[model samples]
Target: MHDTEALQAKFFWFSPGDMTDVRQFFAPGRVNLIGEHIDYNGGHVFPAALTRGVSLWVRPRADGVVRFFSVDFPETIEARVDELEFRPSDGYANYTKGVIKAVQEEAGTLFCGGDFFYMSNLANGAGLSSSAAVEVVTAAAVRALMAYPLDNARIAVLSQRAENDFVGVNCGIMDQFAVAMGKAGHAIFLDCQTLAYEWVPVTLGDYALVITNTNERRGLADSKYNERRSECEAALRRIQEILPDIQNLTQISIDRWDDVETHLASEPNLLRRARHVVFEEHRTNEAVRVLKAGRLAAFGQLMNDSHVSLRDDYEVTGPALDALAEAAWSFSGCLGSRMTGAGFGGCTVSLVRRAAIPEFEEHVRVAYADKTGLQPSFYVSEIGDGVHEQQKEGLEV
Candidate 1:
């Protein structure tokens, strides 16, 4: 948990302001439990928000100058509300500037700038959606500052727009939505096609969700993420000729794909990409059903299956992710393990028995280090709430 007093003191150190008009906001990073590489395919995704995420302290400025500071970086970035644009050199601050521009455009009105101080416990490039957390938290603070009449769901949509339009990453809505509207002790079952969702209770009786980072440092924009998306699109276009009503790859059932697979035999790569989407979509839906029924073993099996499809069919998981996941799978206490996120290199989430967490960690740690020659980081995940104000007593903006 984050220390409010400590964060407030750091905020004062950075901004040199009294606590009179400062409002604090928090947005959690998310872990996709069973869904991998399927959100863009218009499939159902199962994701839960983690306790680790980004927190921001905002003090509205009288002028239009917005100053951004982070505990993770040395330099404070400054921008004008009227001139928010993406700059490659700006690094992480681009997410903040992107959200500010998105809010101004979506709300159809300009808002005052603010001094934004950020602090986060989330590991960047760990497949924990840190960028999404930053975007959502910024949107929440800007909404509070400008009194925008948008709900949490709308906040998610606009944040996604920031990433897609401003940040130039063609990510789906799962990351932003999971971070913006997550409920504690529950995994959201969301349909990417229709955006219909429901909260499913995560009842892991004696099991824990452990996230292991490969420390390979893969960037989403520079990685093969966009290439996989393009391949899926190409497959969808070819399949559309056979079934014109079909919208996305996930819309095709496994049996339906068996009937249509012969048509795409000429393009082997496209076949594999589409195969992953269709089958992975089925696995995700079944995982949700078994999880709701407390069939944890079945849910774990589905997680393992999701990883295989992601590895063989989608061709996303690299050597580091594969080594970590395979090591976890060899442990007897681990119920399931799979590579999560966009996955050229990132993290693997494993469901392990609570009593065996120590052994599980050591086993995987030694094995992964031996195979990859790099140390991996581990975090025991705690499900948490979405973006909201951290209210301070007797303080109002």
Candidate 2:
């Protein structure tokens, strides 16, 4: 919670004098606690939204023009509400425009255009989903401004639509869904294909969730993310030839895997990708079981296994990420560490005792830097609520 009066001074710094009716909203960035790269494969993903996120201060404009100003970036983006399109030079504002376009298309009419001033503390390219944060926060703010009866789930779907259709990124629903429906102190266990979810309470009493950024700055668009997706699609098609009834890789049970394995063995790369998806899905199910039983050590071990499968089978983790994970595993207090996100370069999520965090940070910092020659960043994260309107005295939208 924040003081509305104090936030007014900071949030509306770039506001025009005539703009009086302003409202504040927030959407959070998320970290995948255990599951990784399995979302689009119809597998389970366990992600929790973090307190670190983006904030928006918005007020409707009389002219049907959308103007965006961000404290995080230098350029100001302006456009007509009816003419939103993908522009490479617009930088971060493309996410903002994408959400607006998705919402307008959903509603079948143009609503009020507004001036949006926003800022965020999330690292832009650290694999903590800064793009999803921007898309979700923009969606929520636009929903409020238009007084649309859309729920948070719809907002999340629209945000995913914005990313896939408007921004040209074929992403799964986990990022946007977690950002829109996050709960404090809990992680959402989501079935990416079915979208069935349960809030699993995170009881890491003595353990702390730490994220280490490799600072290699890989964008999902230009990374091998799409190539991986294509590889999986190719594998799925080959498997379907063996068992015509199979719908997705998620349908492959342990008993069925041996039968499907022979079909995929010809293409080593596709075989590896398929193996990762199958095993990671089972790991996610076991994670929920161990987490609920308070078996932190078992859960930690699962995290380590997940990383090995990703590194060897999925082939996403590169040198920098490998070095960071290796460094954390060598540290005494670390229970588990693994590369997270699209994984050519990004962050690693590690679980360590709260008391050991200081020493753990110092050791991993020097060790990872020595191995990669790139200084990494660390964040001790807390789970937080999803996109919502801040409590304050103001006219709604």
* Candidate 1 lDDT over residue span 101-178, tens digit each: 989998898879999988888887788899999999999999999998889998999999899999899999999999
Q: What lDDT does the true structure give each of the candidates?
A: 0.89, 0.86
In angstroms, give how far residue 312 of model 2 lies from its true place: 0.8
lDDT of 1: 0.89
Total clashing pairs for each candidate: 0, 0
Provide the RMSD of all predictions against the true structure, rounded to 1 decimal.
2.2, 2.8
Worst 10 residues of 2 by lDDT: 1-10
Q: Give candidate 2's error at residue 93 in angstroms.
A: 1.4
The whole-model C-alpha lDDT of candidate 2 against the native structure comes to 0.86
Report the Cα lDDT for residue 221, model 1.
29
Over all chains combined, what TM-score does candidate 2 have?
A: 0.94
Candidate 2 lDDT at 343 equals: 87
